[model samples]
Target chain A: MIEHYLSLSVLLFCLGVLGVISRRNVFVVFMSIELMLNAANLGFVAVARLHQSMDGHVLALMVMAVAAAEAALALAVVILLHKHKGNLDTNIFSLLKG
Target chain B: MFDVMVILPLAATGAGAILIMLVAAFETFRREGISILGMGLFAFAFFIQLTVDNSGDIYPFAEVFNGMLVANTFTKVAGLIILACGFFSALAAQTYFTQNKGFVLEFYCMLLFAAFGMLLLTMVAELITLFIALEIMSLAVYTLVGYDRHSVVRAEAVLKYLMLGAFAGAFYVMGAVLVYAGTGSTSFAAIGAVVADSGYLSNPALVGGSFLILFAFLFKAAAFPFHAWVIDVYDGAPLPVTAFMATAVKTSIFAVLANFLLINPEVHQGWVTFLFYLSILTMFAGNLIAIGQQNLKRMLAASGIVHTGYLLIALVALGSERFSGGAILFYLAAYGVATLGLFVALSYLSGQDERRVSFDDFRGLAKVRPYSAACIAIFLLSMAGIPPTAGFMGKFYIIAGAFQAGHAVLAVLGIVSSILSLWYYLRLIIVMYFREPEQRFEVAELTLAPLGTIVLAVCVFAISFYPVVL
Candidate 1:
């Protein structure tokens, strides 16, 4: 039973990673990161159930709070990028080539 | 009371950040006032950190905080470096704002906040606390990176940093969850106990989780594979912000990485082979990138990656029976001083709107401003690991530690990397001294940055004499 939930969590994480890599839209990429974070939250909840402790549950909450903070910052960055370049695509903002 | 004493510096920095935020709202305090306030707060925190008695590892308020934070000589020294970096970066920012266009009142507040996060990052002993501290530092740094929202370059830098940073944060959370699943606890002590009782490789979840955690750390430290973001990001950031990120952020990340790896001898053992190769790749990659760069800031950013590689060598040699992190701390201090010195000098010398950023722009700087050029030469030579400087001693200690740990190959490679690094370091010196003057290299005012540069140049020599017990 635990393995099934763990498998689901890993699948969601992989999907999030795929979204981040394949998607070019900044908003879509950020949503993909949020997806990855929520996947981790799912893993934490499942692992807490397996361990029969509240530690995982509390950590999951903390991860959610941090994710929220990151999302807020990400949105602000998106708006900043949009204001500067007048678009939301990642490819357009290639001023500094890495 | 003892716990409060142990955490006094942390409290000071956090309170200082809030104080700055509130003070920024007032009408009387302008840019100069807030700059002084920021510098004062960092100095205050540095003194507090210096006064804290750190004889051994003390878990402050262990019962109440559940062993989430640990304080020892290692964290103490790292905290001191972070605060000092903040102090000098604030100095650089003051001068940087004088000629540069985008001067925000909240700049110092963000610096204080970032320092506070770094202080917390160094001391965290649990995964969740570490994650929160990491985010706090990252978020503040993101704001500092793009606070001047008008610039397209700043926007691009912040976008790259935030996206990658959030991705790494997710990896860290997942790793923490897996580790908690395997060990049934989040504390380092508990995890180490479990690893000790049952061999590290016997637990699949623990191995996988630790690998992921290491991945996130390497990304933050700007090691080989994840180093692509650093040059662009550092180039786009404001001079002082770049200085802060290069020195302070790297210091805190390495501190936490060392702490995490030292959870158990077995854990360190499992990762040693991997870190060895990664360190080697990071050095050469950094050198190659740095050799090809014409922009001074980009070159410094690549050299920062090479320094990270050297610290990784120290990390690989860590966890020996007599390990005390003396080498790592000493090397960080040396690197921080030189890097901060260069950036501070650049802050004033880059001129209005940072027009004089390329190597060609600085042709024959020594002819015009001999003192500034000499100071920059000292910093560059120190970074290149020349004799009679802190960088030399720092490289000596790390390589010596590697040799003592029986990793003679790593030691030799470190020497070779330093040799390769000199190629770029010397290019700057040649540009400064050997060429004919093209421009006056004038400054509007004498300012605090040049004074800070001299202090740091003196410190580059002064810090070498401080003994490392390794």
Candidate 2:
């Protein structure tokens, strides 16, 4: 059962990586990052069950809180981006390219 | 009681940050007053950190805090360097806002907050605590980067940093989870015990988890392959913020990384081969990028990558019996002073809206602002590892440590990269001295950055005399 959950978590993490790489939309990339964090949370919870300890559960909660903080910051950045360029595409924000 | 003393500096910085935030909200103080406050807070923190007698690894409130924070000579020096970087950056920002527009009241608050996070980062002994500290620093820096919403360039820079930073954060979290799964503990000491009980390579989960965690660290440190965003971000960030990020942030990250690696000799051995190759690639790649840059900021950003490569060499040499962490700490301090000095000098000389950012912009600077030009030259020479400067002594210690650790090839390659770095560092000096002045390097009246630059210039030479055993 733990292996099954771990496999699901890995699958979700892989999907998130794929989304970050393939998607061009800024929002999608951020969502993909959130998905990655969730995958880690899933892994933590499953691993906690396997180890029969509460450490992983606590780690998951901590990760969730960090994820929320990142989300709040990401949303503000998205709004900042929207205000500047009037678009949500990552490719559009290339003024800083070397 | 000793533990409380060890933790006092961290507490002071955090409290100072909150105080600044509250003060900023009231809108009572103007920019100059707040800048002075920020600098004062950093100086206070630096003194507090210096007073702490961290002779050995002292895990503060170990039983009560579950050994989440540790202080030692290494962390103490690193914290001192971080606070000093903050102080100089605040000084630079004071001069910067006098010339340029977009002075926010909350700027000092974010600076304090970032320093607070970096202080926490250096002390973190647990993966979860490390992650939180990393975010706290990252979020504050992100705010500092994008504070000027009116500038489209800043917006673009912030977006790139944000997206990539969040992605890296996710990698770190997943990595922590995997490490937790493998070792069943998040504490460094516990993980070291597990690696000691069972060989590091034999455990597949530990290997993979460490790799992912290292990925996050390397990304933050702007090592090779993960260094693409730094040039752009540093180029776009305000000068003082760039200085802070370049010095304080790197100091903390390397401190934590050294701590993480020192958890066990086996772990360090496991990563040594990887770090060796990465350091080589990072140096040459940075040289290649820096050689083509017309703008001074972009060039400095690239050189930062090269400096990272040098620090990575120090990392590769770490964990040997004879070679202590003094070399790494010394190099960080030397590099921090020189780099921060350059940025502080640039803050004033950049003129209105940063019109003088390119190498060509500084033609004959020695003729007009000879003191400033000389200070910048000192910084550049120090960075290039010229003899009698801190950077030279730092390079000497690191390379000697590398050779002493039986990694002579890395040491030689580091020397070669240092030589290559001169191609760019000297170009600025030549431009500043040889050519005729195009425009007067008029700086704003009563600015402190010039004074900061001179102090750092003296430090570049002074720090060399502080010997580090290899």
Candidate 3:
């Protein structure tokens, strides 16, 4: 059961990584970032169960909170990008080539 | 009680930031008053930090917050450098805004807030605390980067910085989760104890987690593989603000990196080889990039990357056997003071709207404004690691530490890289003194910034003799 959960979490993480690297849309990229974060959240839950401790549970919750804060900021940035370039494509925001 | 002295500046800065926020809400008080108040608070913090002993790490805030934060010798020293950076940058900014005229009362508020976050970063001993402090610093900085919303370049820079920064933050949380899974705790003390007992390397989870965390830090510090964003962002930000980020932000990020690395040898050993190669690549890449840059701010930004490489060498050479990473701290001091001084000088000489930003623009600067040109020359030489200056001493200690720590090849590469760095460092000096004046460069009548520059130039040597300052 634990192995299944861990495997599922790993799969989700890989998918998120793939999405971030392969997708061109800024919204998709941000959503991929969120997917990666939640995948890690899943790992935290699985590891917590395996270790039989409350530490992972609290950590998972803490991550969700941080993720929420990050999403808030990311959305604001997306809006800013939309205003400047009139598109949400990651490649369009290449004014800073570094 | 003396231990508490080290963190007083941090406390004062935080309180000062809150006060500025309140002051910003009122229409009666002005930006000038807030700027002065902020500088005064930071100056007081600097003195407090300067007077503290440098022999050991003080745990003043250790118990107050359940040891989540430390006020050790390393931290106290780093905090002082950062506070001083803030104070001087404020001085430069005050004169800068006089000409540019986009005076927002909350600029001081955000500056103080960022300083507060940097101070907290200096002593953060827990992963969660480090994350929170890092965000506080980065968040405030993002606002400052976009402080001039009128400029499209500035806006673009902030967008780039924010996206990259938030992405790094996400990695930090993921790493923290993995480390927590392995160690049952996230505090540095717990991690250190576990690493000491079971050895940190054997634990794959801890190793992977630390890599993720360190990568995020490298991105923040703008190290070798992760350093691309620096040139553009530094180029776009307002001149005074570029100086602040170059000095204060780098100082704090490095302080925490040293702290994390010093906690356990097992952890340091686990990644020594990787760190060794990364340092070398960072140094060479930085030198190569800086050599090609024509714009003065972009050159300084690239040089900042080279400085990060040197700091990495120090990090690779640092050991957990000793309580203090003295070489790293000293080098940071020397580097911080010189960089801040140069930027302050630029803040004055860059003129309104920064009409002069390239190396050629400074042609015959020595003939036009010899004093400012000479001041800039001093900073450039110090950065080039010329002898008798603090930069020379800093490189000396770090290279010696690298050798002592058994990284002989790294030390040799460090020397070679320093020599390469001189190519660009000297380019500006030659432009200033060797050529005849092209632009009749009118220097700013900014009493505060010029004085700030001279003070920092003196500090390039004064900070070298730790006993005198401490």
For all predictions in the order shown, the interface RMSD in Å is: 0.9, 0.9, 2.3
Which digits, one per residue and each the tens of the lDDT, describe model 1 over residues B164-185?
9888888888788788878999
For the second chain, the TM-scores of the candidates in order are: 0.99, 0.99, 0.95
lDDT of all predictions: 0.93, 0.92, 0.81
lDDT of 2 by residue, B1-470 (tens): 88889989989999998998888877578888899999999999999999989988899969897898998998999999999999999999999999898889889889999998999999999988898899999999999998998988888888889989988888888888788888989899999999888877777878878888989999999999899999999998999999999999999999999998888898788889999999999999999999999998899999999999999999999988788788999999999999999999999999999889999999999999999999999999999999999999999999999998999999999999999999999999999999999999888999898899999999999999998877
DockQ-based CAPRI category assigned to the predicted complex of candidate 2: high
Model 1 chain A poorest ten-residue lDDT run: A78-87
Clashing pairs in 1: none
Quick one: best lDDT, which candidate?
A: 1
Flag regions of model 3 displaced more than 4 Å. Answer: A1-6, A45-62, B1-7, B50-66, B320-324, B467-470
Ten residues in sequence with the least summed lDDT for candidate 2 chain A: A89-98
Candidate 3 lDDT, tens digit per residue, B1-470?
75466667777888888888887898887767777887887887788678766556555656675576777677877887788788888888887776675568888878888999999998898876787789889988888887674566777788778767877776776788678767877778788888888886678878778888878888999998889989989988888788899989999998998888787787677768888888898999988999999998899999999999999998888883332477777888788888888888887788888878899989999998888888888888899999888899888888877887878999999999999999999999999999999788776563588888888888877766663111
- Backbone clashes, each candidate: 0, 0, 3
> Clashes in model 3: which pairs?
B57-B72, B57-B73, B58-B72
Each candidate's DockQ score against the native complex? 0.86, 0.86, 0.46
The reply for model 2, stretches above 4 Å from the true place, is none
